[model samples]
Target: MLLTLIYLIASVTFIVGLKMLSNPATARNGNLIAAGGMTIAILGTIFLYEEDGQKLGNYGWIFGGIAVGTLIGFLAAKKVKMTAMPEMVSLFNGMGGACAMLISIVEFDHLFNKDSGVNFEWTAYPPLSALTSDSFFISALPMGQLLIILLGLIIGTVSFTGSMIAWGKLNGKVKDFSFKNQQVLNILMLVLIVAAASYLLWYCNQVGVKINVLTGMDNTNLPTESFFTNVKIIFYGLFVLSILYGVFFVLPIGGADMPVVISLLNSFTGVAAACGGFLYDNKVMLTGGILVGAAGTLLTILMCKAMNRSLANVLIGSFGGNKATGGGGAGKDQGTYKEISITDTAVVMAYANKVFIVPGYGLAVAQAQHVCHELEKLLESKGVEVKYAIHPVAGRMPGHMNVLLAEADVPYEKLLEMEHANEEFSTTDVVLVLGANDVVNPAAKTDPSSPIYGMPILDVELAKNVIVNKRSMKPGYAGIENDLFFQPKTSMLFGDAKKVLQDLVGEIKNL
Candidate 1:
């Protein structure tokens, strides 16, 4: 009863925390609440959990593992730079997938080897001898139990390998890999996985049961040694196949779509975790997994919409690679770009009544959020209104720009999403783009051949004046030169984001 109550508390906290995450104001507190509830649940399980009239032991091992994990996690997060946050998220998510995969493997071993001189008295492994014939499969284990185990193993393995690949790609350790007919191979692998798993189920159902087809009668017996041998081979084979499939599944996806892929992989891990929860009949674990799965799936769909790409496109389209070509606009002439001096930019922004600043990946790369915020403050002091426009899919990961700006103590109200910012752009006096490129590029709407075409972008060109800060005239991650750079109303301010923002702050303070 106490464990049940603890589970209920943890479940409630998870729900509330997830809800709080929707709003930036309560996101921090909500995270803390959810973490606190998880701590309570862990303590309750470690101290009071019992099954089959036996309690948990090995306190030294359990606490030691937890301590090491806590220390590693703490140091990783504390020492990691803001720019590499996406890689860190991918790495941590991979760890969750690994945990689920390990759980499924351990549980499968216990289920199959319980009576073969391998006593698992420390665990709450259901006694095969005690299980009745009611609703039972003809196999050694229940059909539902076996299904959960296999699913957890396959999904967990896929998520682990896929997340690792994503981490590698984000950190520049791995590049996008694709070949001819990659999608066809991906589909074939999926079909093979389904067929193999289905055959295993059929084998388990008929391992020792001899059916007289002409007589239309069957005799069911216990599974034979041959069945165990075959099952082991098929199960392990399935595991390896899933790992390879995950590698291929993410290998062809372009860098531009990685945010969506990460969200999708996150959902896979959640589903795998939920399967483990089902295997263990743990309510808190089940609730947490379900919440994560649902939220991740929903967020993926929203991100897809924000990018103006379908989920299918992100998964199989192989859209944008990381090969940057700094030249004219995707084979078309964009003419020459005009440069703006620091003094001219400061004067334009200082005298303007309203200015909108759009942030992108370069801002994060340069770690200029603080100085950017400082420039905003200095401009606001001179009677100019400053607001930040955040593209949904901007930066390396989802919510990357928001987190960056938040770290610099920017007001939540001052940061506007693309949709809301677009409505105000036409009326604004000036739009200051900070290290942004493709997002403010007019090609997305005008040039159909552009890789980022049809994707939602901040309409910075609608403003009366436009000033973009970039280190070079290079194309963005989508590998297309921005048409906005060469526009008559646009002026480029070339420098590192941090240095430019510092210069702008100094210029605006004097103005």
Candidate 2:
């Protein structure tokens, strides 16, 4: 009863924490509250949970592993730069997947060995005289337990391998790998996985029947020990195949859709964890896993919508491998782009009645969020209405730009999403794009041939004057040149984002 109370408290806290995360203001406190609840659940399980009158032992090893893991996690979170935050998230998520996978593996081993102290014997019933005059009836394999184990093994392994691939891609350590008929191969492998699992379950059912019938018969009809050995081999084969399928599942996807893939893999891990919870009959673990699974699935769907791509296309299509050329007024570089001096750009922003700031991955790379905020304040002091335009998938990960701006104490109201920002662009006098390219590019709407053609973008071109700050004329992460750069109304301000923003702030002050 005490353990149940602890679990209830943990479940309530998890729900409240998830609700609080809907707004940025309470997210930190919400995270802390959730962590505290999890601590309570773990402590309750370690100290209070028991099975067959036996409590947990090996305290030293358990606590020692916990201490080492906590220390490494703390150091990693503290030291990782904001620019590499996506990679860190992927790494941490992979760790969660690994934990769930290991849990499933250990449980399977316990069940298969039987000598590991867990009883899994089947009960026999008397046979009906109509069916067999002198035969014994036996229960089939515990299908519920077998199904849960299979689910945990499949989803957990996929999450672990897929998340590792995502981490590598985000960190620039891995690239998209594809071969002819890859999609077909993936489908075939998936079918084989299902077939193998079904065969294993059937084998288990047959073995159970044989063992039960032999219990009531003479030794002459008993099955050989090699039958059990073959069952173990089938189990091992299923595990190995599932692992290979996971690798193949994620290997063909390009880097551009990594954010969505990460969310999907996160959901997979959550479901896998829920399987573990089911196996152990733990309410707190089940609640936590369901919450994560539901939230991650929703986030993945939202990301897919933002990109204007279907989930199937994201998984199977090679969209970001090569840059698209031509179409949407991007036929060759007919003319060089216009350049603006820092003083002139500052003058335009200061004189404007309203200004819009569009941020992107480069802003994070240059670590200029604070200085950008300083420039906003300076412009506001001159009676310029300043606001920021944030794309949904901006900066490597979802909400990444918002996090950076929040750190600089940017007001929540000033950060506008793509749809709202697009509506305000036409009424605005100046749009200062800070190291942003693809999100603000006009090609998305105008060029059907472009890789990011159907994706929604900020309508920065509608503003009277546009100033773009960039280090060079290089294409964006999609490897496509932005046609917006060559427009007559757009003036390029070439420099590092931090340095450029610092200079612009000084110029605005002098004006």
Candidate 3:
């Protein structure tokens, strides 16, 4: 009862924390509350849990594993740069998937160990007792329990392998891999997985496990050992197939669609964990899994919407670095771009009625969020209204740019979403684009031939003056030239994002 109370508290905390996570101001506190609840739950389970009146043992192995994992996680997080956050998230999520997968495997082993020499006399699982001669069910394991185990194993393996692939892709360790009719092949794999699982379930229900029948002598009516061994083989085969399917699942997906893929994989992991909870009847684990699964699914939908694509389109279209019609723009001439001086930019922003700052992956790569915030503060001190224009898909992951800016202590109210920022661009005086590309491209609206044509973009071009900071005129992930750079109103400010923001801060202060 005490352990149940602890789980209840933990479950409530999960719900409250998830609700608080929706708002930026409360997100940090929300994380802490959830973590505290989890810690309490773990402690209660370790000390108060008694399964069948058998107290938990192996404290050394349990705490030692915890210590090692905690140390590794702490070190990895501390050393990870903001730019590599997407990959890090994938790696950690993969670990969760792995844990769920192992749980399913271990539980299945414990229940179905063939060498245990324990004869089943209709006493193991009450659910199996109802089976008559014609009932034709195999093993002392209940069908319901077996289903949960299979579900967890399949989903967990898929999430684990898929997330690892995603992590590799995000870190540039793996390249997109696809072939002719790749989508068709993926569909076939899905069908096979379903077929195999169905066959296993049917086979188990069709025959009962051998009872009191040994092959020494007079075993004519005994169930053949070979038949039972085949059942075990089928289960192992299903596990292997799941691993292959997972690898292929994420291989064809392009980098731009990684945000949605990551979210989807996260949902898979959650559902798998929930299966484990159901298997063990753990309330806290179940609640946490449900929350994570639901949240990830919703986030996946939002990510797809932000990209202006359907979930199916994202999975099969493989739209990104692969479909690049290069040269940074359409075949037409866009004219030459003019470069702007830092001093001139500083003067324009300082005297301007309003200025809009747009951040992108380059800003993250340069670790310029802090300096960028500094620049914003300096501009505000001069009575210039400064606002940040945030595109939904600005960084590698959803809410990534928000997190980066938040780390620098930027005000949440000053950061505007794409829709609101677009509405304000027409009234803004100077637009400073920091290391952003595809999100600000005018071709998304003007050129149908471009890969990102139908995608929504921030209308930074609508502002009176546009200053774009980039290391070079290199195309972004879209692989097409951005015509926004060639616009008469646009001026290129070539430099590293951090250096440019630092210089801008100094120049603005001097003015």
Between candidates 1 and 3, which one is better according to TM-score?
Answer: 1
Superposed model 3: Cα runs more than 4 Å off: 117-140, 209-223, 321-329, 332-335, 341-343, 381-383, 446-454, 503-511
RMSD for all candidates, in order, please: 4.6, 3.8, 4.3
Top of the candidates by TM-score: 1
- Model 1: clashing residue pairs? none
Off by over 4 Å in 1: 114-137, 208-226, 321-329, 448-451, 506-511
- The digit string of per-residue lDDT tens for model 2 on 1-511 reads 7999999999999999988877778988898899999999999988998888889999999899999999999999999977778888888888888888788778777766677433455544444544553444354445567778888888888788888888998887888788878888989988988998888776666644532233465322323477567767877787787778878888878766788889899888888889988988888889999889999999999998888878987887646433334333455564879999999998899999999999988898899999999999988988899999999988878888998998889999999998899899999999988888888877788778777788899889999999999999987766677888888999999999999999988888887
Candidate 3 matches the true fold with a TM-score of 0.87
TM-score of each: 0.88, 0.87, 0.87
What Cα-based lDDT does every candidate model obtain? 0.85, 0.83, 0.85
Order the candidates by lDDT, highest first — what do you get?
3, 1, 2
Better of 1 and 2 by lDDT: 1
